[model samples]
Target chain A: MSSSDLLLGLSQKALQLLQEDADKIEKLIEVQMENLTTRQCPLYEEVLDTQMYGLSREIDFAIRAELIQESAGKQIMVKLERNLAQLYEALSQSKE
Target chain B: MSSSDLLLGLSQKALQLLQEDADKIEKLIEVQMENLTTRQCPLYEEVLDTQMYGLSREIDFAIRAELIQESAGKQIMVKLERNLAQLYEALSQSKE
Candidate 1:
């Protein structure tokens, strides 16, 4: 399958699992973000940014598809923004 | 960037974010897997498998690249297998 399709599938799966509890999903996302911040490579960082962005987009799709609750989606978004801010911090730190 | 590159980049980032805590990483993976299991489409299920397989390969690459601890890598593999089994089960259920 195409990468986009693959991502969509995984995103759908993830929503199925986590759609019931935004807090739990947010925590899991935090774990992912923590893993992302350890890399020093710019390319790697770009990849992280891209993946999170893509996942977020998929979450949006889930909402549009009516596959997930709006509250859950919003929780995910908040978590994503938090991780993104941390990612920015991590990226800036590596510049030193 | 190419899809492979994007996946690679994100994998590295995920390792960076999560290399320290195998349990935590596994939990996040479980969350992702749970999200993946909700889709009933064969194409979508294939996508989930592909994504996980790709991520596992990336983990192997990281091990070779000396980006993450070997023990952590093993943990990821275990978690991957567990999720894969669940994915299989989910796929089978949908086929019924």
Candidate 2:
């Protein structure tokens, strides 16, 4: 299987395990982000590795898991790009 | 440092290690992907784990590494989504 298929399979499997509530999944992501910011993720290195392999996979998963239309992913991408810039600005400001 | 910063830093560092040719980075990704399908990535599982933690990082890396613009990320993401679907269809055709 291609990595994407493997990932999509895993995504389908994981979501099967989840309750299929878009709100819950979004909340889950939010909570995950909160956890990342609040705690030290020692496993960050490992996770980042998988990310290199399947960055597109999780993105595709989020699209389906959240029932986001194709256009929505674009908006999300734009928002995330802006958010990262804002975050960097905030961090840079704090550092100065 | 935040995870994004860590990634961006590593990305900057890796590119520094590379020769700063966007084509080289894209070729590297293509080669890595071809290797993935041709060989068994025993490390795939670990990488996948990290991916859940930082999918956005690699995407950003590719963007900067390739010198793709803000809107280009969106277009790339869309093409990727389509490519994945095509890959899946091809795989299923092979299996049947």
| Native contacts conserved, per model | 0.03, 0.00
> In each prediction, how many residue pairs overlap at the backbone (N, C-alpha, C within less than 3 A)?
9, 8
RMSD per model, one decimal: 20.4, 19.0
lDDT of 2 by residue, B1-96 (tens): 554454445345433422232333344344445555455445643443343234334344334333234564455445444544454454446446
RMSD of 2: 19.0
lDDT tens per residue, model 1, A1-96: 667765555445556544333444446445645665464444654555445544554455345434456787777677767766776686567557
Error of 1 at A57 (Å): 20
Model 1 RMSD, rounded to 1 decimal? 20.4
Residue A87 lDDT, candidate 1, scale 0-100: 60
Off by over 4 Å in 1: A1-96, B1-14, B17-39
A1-96 per-residue lDDT for model 2 (tens digits): 554454445345433322222333344344445554455355643443343234334344435333224564455445444544454454446446
Q: What is the lDDT of candidate 1?
A: 0.55
Give me the overall lDDT of model 2.
0.41
